[model samples]
Target: EAGVAQSPRYKIIEKRQSVAFWCNPISGHATLYWYQQILGQGPKLLIQFQNNGVVDDSQLPKDRFSAERLKGVDSTLKIQPAKLEDSAVYLCASSLEGGYGYTFGSGTRLTVV
Candidate 1:
């Protein structure tokens, strides 16, 4: 089966600019997640969505970050007025259940200049 898909594998943005990342999960998977990974650090869950509704977003920086899963399939994550500190790899993952059998994308590497 195909794994999760993510676009623009790499991105370069200026500080204060906005960027959006898209994701398409494996067929039939019901749980999706967005994670941020800084170099040398483990990926941190930014948000989790079950179908079209959000399940967890406790670590998301609500003021500048946002995400949505549409129709229980595709999802998008956006960061507006991005800061230099936001330069990191953004990962998209999907699972059949909340915390098991996760399939992650190659990741979108954002370089804030």
Candidate 2:
């Protein structure tokens, strides 16, 4: 199966700066997700989108993190005033409507100093 696509495979920024990551999901996939993965830990789901609407974003940090999937095919995740603790890889994924096996991108590694 074809996989999700992500841009700027790596990024480095200072604390209190901002960064953004982009993703393009597989064709015909209705469910899209953004996950954060810190070193030594599992990926944490940050947001979910079904079609062009938000399905869940409870885990997203509203004060500094935001995401959008405007057309249901591409998405973006942004972090503003990034914190040192925010250094991690951001993964984008997608699946069929049932939430089963997901196709993930290569991920964007963000390093905050």
Measured by TM-score, the strongest candidate is 1
Q: Which candidate is the best by lDDT?
A: 1
Clash totals for all candidate models: 0, 0
Q: lDDT tens string, model 1, 7-110?
A: 98999999999999999999999999999999999999999999999999999999999998878899999999899999999999999999997999999999
Clashes of 2: 0
For model 2, the superposed segments whose C-alpha errors exceed 4 Å read none
Candidate 1 displacement at residue 108 in angstroms: 0.1
Lowest lDDT 10-residue stretch of candidate 2: 95-104
